[model samples]
Target: MGHQTETHVWDEELAPEPRGRTWRPEAGCPVEVALAAVSGRWTTLLLRELMGGPRGFTELRTLFPDLSAKVLSERLRTLRERGLVAVERRRGFPVRTRYELTRAGEALRVLLVELYATGEELLRLTTASETRDERSPGRLEA
Candidate 1:
């Protein structure tokens, strides 16, 4: 199917999806910013956990048993640097630290939801493709 590209914004037809000011997605691009926010392994999961509410360091470790404390700390640090996560320290017998998403970070809820839906669609398409390939004439599997 084909579609028209005449719809205008800023008095110009906007660049197609995946294109920024340049061919490559440069700094300050929305795509780049979003990717940077969710770049590292376990980053998205950490965000998801924080999305529920603020969580202490120990709670995060317990929630993700497979994730090492070192890696978990690093991910949280990165999120903080990106302004997607906020950290609060409570003075007590043992100083407690809790992590929560900032206002900008909370906006990622929509993005995560969309990513999940889009991933499901992509997986479905991939599975369908594999089935078609298996039934293709003259196809061989090793």
Candidate 2:
């Protein structure tokens, strides 16, 4: 019988395909790769912004005032290395540089949208539960 999960049923056992025994986060792991691509503060926001169109460093920094310039640069560099973002340097008086999502990055659009929806649902449920608990005196506080 397959291993049972909330959202999936493994045909045999839930294990890494290539790593037969130990599953660890490394370049060879696809799950790790996906998580690494999107794991960082302001990363999803950057990708979301790029979804609309290409943007320059100053433009992104201006849009997100709270995000520091150093952090922004680091995130962009990581994204570029991950092959999720393409950097275009337009030689001019000021040397304009633009950042846009690559094909792989664009593929994450659905994932981001779904993540937002899931988060909203979780928040809604939590709020409703909290409101009920506050109003109900019979509710036990544990």
Best by TM-score: 1
Pairs clashing within candidate 1: none
Question: What is candidate 2's lDDT per residue for 113-139, written digit by digit as tens?
Answer: 988999999999999988988999877
The per-residue C-alpha lDDT of model 1 at residue 61 equals 98
Clashes of 2: 0
Give the TM-score comparing model 2 with the true structure, all chains together.
0.78
Q: After superposition on all CA atoms, how large is the RMSD of candidate 2?
A: 5.5
Listed in order, each prediction's TM-score against the native is 0.83, 0.78
Give all candidates' CA lDDT scores.
Answer: 0.88, 0.86
* lDDT tens digits, residue span 47-68, model 1: 9999999999999999999999
